[model samples]
Target chain A: MASETKLSHTTALILHALDAGLVYGFSVMEMTGLPSGTVYPALRRLERDELICSQWERQSIADAEQRPARKYYKLTVAGRATLEASRRRYPLLERLIPTVEAKQV
Target chain B: MTARVDMVVRAFQRGFLSCISLLVPSGQRAEWRREWQAELWHVRRACAPAGAVSWQAEREVTAFCLGAFQDALCLRLHAPKNEPRIALLHGSALQCLLFLGGVLAASYGLTLLLPGVRVESHPERYQVRSGLIMIQDEAYSNDWVAATIPVERFRDWETTRQRYFDGLAFYRIGEQAVSAGSHGTGGWEVAEASKNLFSLLGLPVRFASQEGEADAGLPQAILSDAVWKREFGGDPRVVGSVLRVGGRDVRIAGVAAEGGWRLPGKADVWLLERDSEIAAGGRGHVVAHLTNQGRSEMWASYVHIDAYSPDEPGDNLCGFSFEERTRGPWGIYQFTVLLAFLALPAITTVSMGEYSVSSHRPSWSRRLCRWGYMGAKIALLLPIVYFLSLDVAYWHTTLYSLASEYAQLAASFSICLFGLRWALLDQRQRCPVCLRHVTNPARVGLASRTFLAWNGTELMCTAGHTLLHVPGLPTSWFSTQRWLYLDTSWEFLFTGSGVG
Candidate 1:
């Protein structure tokens, strides 16, 4: 039930981007070519659905970078399960990105 | 160069985001605006080169704006209010019901405040703008002067149907001025009316009987006995003498009837415009008889006629049958249209949303009172429109018409200024929470109510912090009905039915 897979291509792309360590909203946009308006609200809905969780990056890190602090998203356990199912269902998602060992936030 | 381009991009982004937010829901609109603009900045920064906009940059900007429209559309679709539900239906239904009740209550309220106003007394006679001659009686007059009869239209419509319709061409009472005396150039108001005005309004013009004193198509003014004395000190030489008025020198045609003809606007010192015929083929104000068989009404009306409450008899009703005067929907619709069109929906929304007191006074009490003031004046001045338009002798008899309306208008002007707060003012309850006087408390609907007393009053503090201090109930619906012991009257008691 937690991994109940109803993943669309757009959702799979977003999940794959999160797994690839492109966690920030702008970073996700860079990875998936999705607009910020779409990506931000989707992030909110995903968080609401408990498939993704987010936290603001450290202010000091942003100060050093001379930019606003970015909010970061990481897949929850349920989200990971869903992603696993989505990867199988949408095999091209994996082929489109570099393979990397996913780390838990 | 890069900085300049960045500045330009940021400015354009700011303008676009501001426009997009107009469609966003009120609750999340600000937050979404800031978030999207920030994201847009990032997209543009990433896509733009150091000095100029690239094709990729423009595409990114376009995509971002398009996405913004999508998000705004979603937000606007259903930003449901978080409110309570009870006996009747859901929260949305309750809100709609409350809104409708407020409007109805306001309409009912208007009757209470403005009792005794009659609709028929309002002069409603105006002509269509089909090449009619226009006369500026004055900005304050706002009266329809006359319509011109183009030769072509006259030949086509009137001359063709001359046997059936006796309606004449070029009806107008052009406003002209006269000297109060040589006391340092004082101006007196007068009308330069067409001769047809005299016949239409049942007025008679007295031409100078002396030989050669009549107008030979020159500017000719006639002094009434009143103006004859006041301006010329009753000098008989004033007759047929030159009286300079409206920057033109004109001979006094004759002294009008003692008090001046009973005309609308009580125009004395009239000049038969030598150019009155010029309006025949020229632009003219469209005017009909001020008193028609069915009576008359003024269109483009901000002036409300005196209305007696349905609870009372309106003797001044301009002869409308009682049913027409008191019909509910038409009157309210008229007011609703009036409020919506003039104030651009704010007044309508305010009137509909604010309904704290209903029973004895109903919510629209103050508006009714203001309408009463205006309507009473209209009733009082009912004869003015007819007399003036027809250049009749009635203005002499109703000498106080203009002054009476002016007095009422002054009162209404003050009332209109106060109507803003009075729209929200509920007479039954007083606001004591803020101790900020009677004006500080607002009526916030109860979160939940049963069918019982419907909507009761709550005194709320509105200065920064919200503190609802509710007074005890005066009465409930149960006070009236003899319920069978098992009747579902408890919904009236336990749940909020009328707490809007």
Candidate 2:
């Protein structure tokens, strides 16, 4: 149901950030330099579009550190396709976000 | 330390989370709150290297606050065709007051009618507690162990009580003319008791004190029937006659009922505790009732000069134990009833939560959730405790002045009771979507914004649906200014391009 071609620059940036290994919300915020307001909603929209999927990090990791569990995001096949297409659409994103081949999973 | 910064951020997050609770469906409330909190935690930690009291929380939380508003609005716009938007009944103010008020009114009515934890025979006994120290139940198990009432805590309460209670009789005792009346005169020993001490002791009033008379510049005293018989020859007119107490000639306002009287010291006369008695640290016995959790406070109000733990455990009963008839068999029954009220839905201490917090810190918003729960409980109790202290302060100040005081207490306590009960009982302790009773419940409140029970937690139903929502404090007040500034700018930038 998602209109992928209409993806906004913010959405593309978030997808690229996810592919580039800036997986969690704040990490994506750091990689993209977008505010929490922008980053969270964009993530929600991308997930809704089936371009990305998220799972909570292991509880042990959060326990090892003294903090809350982080939600980790990874590109779906569709998400990878979108990121590849976005790289062409937003040329600057290629430099900002990592390519999928650079990531192991 | 990070504590100071944590305080401010926690307060903002608490209020913001309370508002967010209103937007999500009830079934999903618990889950969403946790997820959002976790997200916020990560957001803050990511910037923790910035400083302990980083500006990041302000910037980050503000964005999150705005995001909640956007989510509420956008989620509504993007709601699936079959799913209805999350909607709380948009009742008129009167309607809100009517339903919520009715629930509150009933909760208090029940509390007032129900006798709190009590020993049927010894009504004046209290379970002593203090802010600085908590006397665990083990200490209460033995015979009465004495703890010197914390004068400092009482003094702090004395100084700060005016902030919550409006009554002058109790707090403004310093302003009263310390009665120049005789302190010790006739062989008449005097006892100081609360207004309901007689009724609490299962005795009836032989002569009733007039409402407001305690504040009317008239001295008030209650004579035991024996004392009345011996001193005034049982003359009915003695009720209005003045009896010398301390330096003041306190009027004989009433005579205690005669039959089955069993008070320690068997004082000939009873009167309201005076301001000076508080200063003097009156020695008294500890009264532990199975129901009242806040007993030490009663001791702190009076009993000024004694040391805490007046006797060794060998000589005293200190801890709380119902398994052995420490007080009496009836005390056990009373405790069971109290426990039932606290644990069962529609009883006392009702918590409405769907999911318990799964893990401790490093869980995003870990400290915030724990602190928020504590803050909520304090926020709920502060006003009740405030007015309660006022009643303690205003004891016998005026005839009939107690009705309003008690009504204030009942109202506040009822609100707490109503919140937990409504979430549990009226809602059937089930997830609205799944209609399963298998749910957890918790109560939450705004930080520093005590007296309002706006935030109720949500849990997922066994059906795994997160589609129900509960009514909450309308956040219009919280949103107004922010809406004008952040929202206006927010909408100005992104209104036409609303997201799915």
Candidate 3:
């Protein structure tokens, strides 16, 4: 089922953003330059399909930063494989989102 | 000022998210709201920054909140194929109440369409319209007795009525041997009335659709509802037929509606004669329509008219009373329903068994949902009972009379009592925590050994929220059923049970 599942360009951008360590929804929205309307549903579809997983961050970490705990998202093993296949299909998916090391810089 | 603006923006975003949460499946709604709220906090920090507001950034945050709708819609659409059905025929309180409401609306719609049901349901139309008065002599204190005025005096009043009354109508009641075509002759009470009486009183006499068909030479006759049923067998063709009354042939003009026009005493027929000798010398009853000025002076029991004089001085006093209207069937229904509710405790056990101490009291919103479910069921059931009783009472007969009135009262009272009992019983079977009807009742202990074991049936909430224990036999210690709330530790037993 995963092999035949085709990803739209918007979905590919969100997957690439997640793979690039843009783990939070706002960060993925910022990196992809996509409006929240396009980004959130794509993330949900990917998560429901088991291509991505999410969890709430520890409260202590958020307390130290003096903010509410954020829900974090990351590519699963299946998600990474799907993103590799999507890159071949979309061609310029790599250029749309920077790698984790590039994002840190 | 900027801080206040930020507060407003944040509130708007949160409110939008809360609305979107409703579209998500109930099991996932809380988690979905938590994720959106957390993201909203981060989005605002990045967009507006502290102590400063950017309209562009605020717009972006607004756009982010709007996105939650698509996500919630996606989740709701893709909700598990075998997701637990919210409405189990046994348990969903909301579904049950909504079903009752639908039935009520459908019944009311039917009442509007069916003529018999329509007449019984709306009593105001058959009642006497406002401002009708029965004029009587001062000596006639008893309203039951018909008071008469000399035809000359009535004609004088009709011609010279300058105040208090718009119009005056006269009718003299007398028994006449009446015979219809092939129907046996009977002595029927007949009213010899002026031709303009019905028009003056504004009473609608239902005539056959084909007008001007009756014999022009003969006088006209309007049949009372009882005479129409008894003599003519309620055939509409009876109109335009000839009837022999007091040895004179009269053409049937129309029929009076049931429960209509009870003034000037009861009569089976009204003879509308264009020119009658009664006006020359005979005495008859008088009914008058009050003018607006007459209405203003209605507080007093009698009106002193300059036109009226007596044979002896100080004996000219005359009085008027508003026409008495029949008690509406709807009033009887309301009275019986009230009596039924008051008698409910005497017939059935009214207490819903106490919740166990181990179970936490439901939160305020949960309590509201539970009680609101009961209130909605009763609200819908009442109209259903009312319309159904009207249907039962008037199903075969088109007439609204004493018999149908009694039928409606009995039907409404019985249905209301049983319907209310069922509502309370159904509410008792529901799980307070989830407001769903508890299911899977299994008898756990022996009925004969009630002293040692907790002898009763055990019912479980389908959602794993609680278990209900109903005693098969009552004891001093365990007289009523109780509910035990199940904690998360007991949830494993309900896994793969189609509960979300």
Candidate 2, residue A33: lDDT: 78
Query: Which residue segments of model 2 deviate by more than 4 Å?
Result: A1-4, A98-105, B1-6, B54-65, B81-500
A11 Cα displacement, candidate 2 (Å): 1.0
Candidate 2 shows a clash count of 68
* Top lDDT model: 3
lDDT for each residue of candidate 2 in B1-500, tens digit (9 for 90 to 100): 37786787778876786686677656556755766788777656555645556566567666756666665555544546532221222211223334544544554444343332112223323221212121222333332233322333333323443322221111111112222123324545555543334443444556675742555565466676666676667777656656555566567677775532332234566665443344445333322232233333334422222223223322221323222222322333334334434744545334433332222112336435534443443444333333333333234332112243344345335544544454344333333232333234344565345335445344333333322233244354331111001212234443342221
Alpha carbon lDDT at B49, candidate 1 = 49
Writing each residue's lDDT as its tens digit, candidate 3 over A1-105 gives 274468998998898888876388888888899977788888888988899998888888889989888778888888888888898899988877776642321
TM-score of each: 0.40, 0.31, 0.59
Tell me the tens digit of each residue's lDDT in model 1 across B289-356.
Answer: 32232133433322232323334443221111212222222242344333433553344233322222
Model 1 stretches astray by more than 4 angstroms: A35-38, A100-105, B1-6, B49-59, B78-500
> For residues B122-215, could you state the per-residue lDDT of candidate 3 as single tens digits?
5544665567676666556464345567776776666664588887778888888998869889899998887777877666788632453345
List, residue by residue over A1-105, the lDDT tens digit for candidate 1: 379768678877888888865366777877787876677667766776788887766768868977655567898889989999998898889777666555333
Ranking by TM-score: 3, 1, 2
